[model samples]
Target: MSRFGDPEWGRRRGGRLTPPEGLGVLTALIGKQLRARLGSPAAPPARPDLDLALPDSRLVQDALDHCAAECAPDIVAHSIRCYAWGVLLADLRDIRFDREALATAALLHDIELGRTERRDRFACLCFACAGAEGARIFLEARAASPDRVTRVCDAIARHLNPDVPLKPYAESHLLNAAAALDVVGAGARALDPADRARVLATWPRGDFRRTMQAAMRREQAAAPNTRAGLLMQLGFGGLIARAPFGDTL
Candidate 1:
């Protein structure tokens, strides 16, 4: 078995690794992900002309307002970035989703990080139900959908696992991308400039824009399709380029 632990160990051991290197392994895996996969377009944005049914941008603006009022300014900024990325990922993947709900959920996923005094606690709570209350608070304030709210909560709960495999067709890929982005940006000490650049190249802006435009052209070449379906294709392509394990993770 790999030193990181066996793939099935998580299931057999209640998702806990033997010797508790599980946490360190998880941190290292996320570091490798950040070094290798973060920022690669997991999908393409919808055609420029497609009108997404996202809640008015004002909802995000309002969440930002409320977050700033109640949480630390750093938290507010991180929340905004997560929301923006979540919405973008949803848009790129063509997932028939409530954009407003996704953004609100993503933004608040880490709200409890503000409360944990220790790093391990912060990391642990970030992946457990401890943060659910905070996420619920954020979603409730905006009157978001309960189902979407639950999904966001679930994503937060699983954001840190080193052993859990991503559901192949689910939106978990986007959530994984977001979590790794943050960890790599902040905690990946082993990563150097060369490594970051190599990873970033996986989703180079020029390639993303070109691939997205091409996907749009292909979709429009046939009968028009729903905005969400098109985004889903884009997201799939992006994930193909940056997913943690080429064929497995």
Candidate 2:
């Protein structure tokens, strides 16, 4: 089995955080905010490499169609915006990555999250791992290449990390950064203001905060032992509520 398929192995570190890392997340986000305000390039610009639109490919379109059909409008918008931010961050950071893989990972990282009403879907595993498995089955049914499938699923599995390393996991790193920025304002400053505006204007934030907060709370209630559940226990909702964009959205 691929290492990613091993839930125990994945939980060992990627999703499970060291206490220091867990504690450092809020501090790091505040630091990023302060640096951006004080005229420091704390991270790369989330400026798009292309116009803000879906990549012209059958696979991406299929993923979007599936996501939209299954997810809430807010969740669908969040996933699309994640794709926009992921590509933009990748280009600005000079990271060599597969665009399609990044987009697929971004759009489906929260696949298992759609039907949170059925909490049993992820009662025993991290939502990220469950999402990754769901994404894999969906992609394989569409005959996505093995390497692409592996990378996309691996990225979904890892996006819950406080920080994903860019070396061997560029796509994962970008997806995590974008997802975090949308949810907790992790790299809010790195994204160019104008570009960020464009993405949000196109996708619309809707009731994302409430939707995602509910999802997180449900996950925490169902799997308190998982990293996400543990983090939610550590006041993760407050962090999401306090994101810089929260005021406007």
TM-score of each: 0.46, 0.82
lDDT of 2 by residue, 96-202 (tens): 88888988888888877735455454423677877877787899999999989878977888787666777566787888889988898776677678777888788
- Encode model 1's per-residue lDDT on 177-247: one tens digit a residue: 55445332322222333333333333233333233334334433331222212323334235435533222
Which parts of model 1 have CA positions greater than 4 angstroms off?
1-54, 57-62, 90-96, 117-128, 137-144, 162-172, 182-249
Stretches off by above 4 angstroms in model 2 are: 1-49, 114-124, 246-249
Q: Specify the poorest-scoring 10-residue window by lDDT in model 2.
A: 1-10
Considering only N, C-alpha and C atoms within 3 Å, which residue pairs clash in candidate 2? none
How many clashes (backbone atoms < 3 Å, residues ≥3 apart in a chain or on different chains) does model 1 have? 14
Question: Residue 129 in candidate 2 has what lDDT?
Answer: 78
- Model-by-model lDDT, in order? 0.43, 0.74
- Candidate 1 versus truth, CA RMSD in Å, comes to 16.2
The best candidate in terms of lDDT: 2
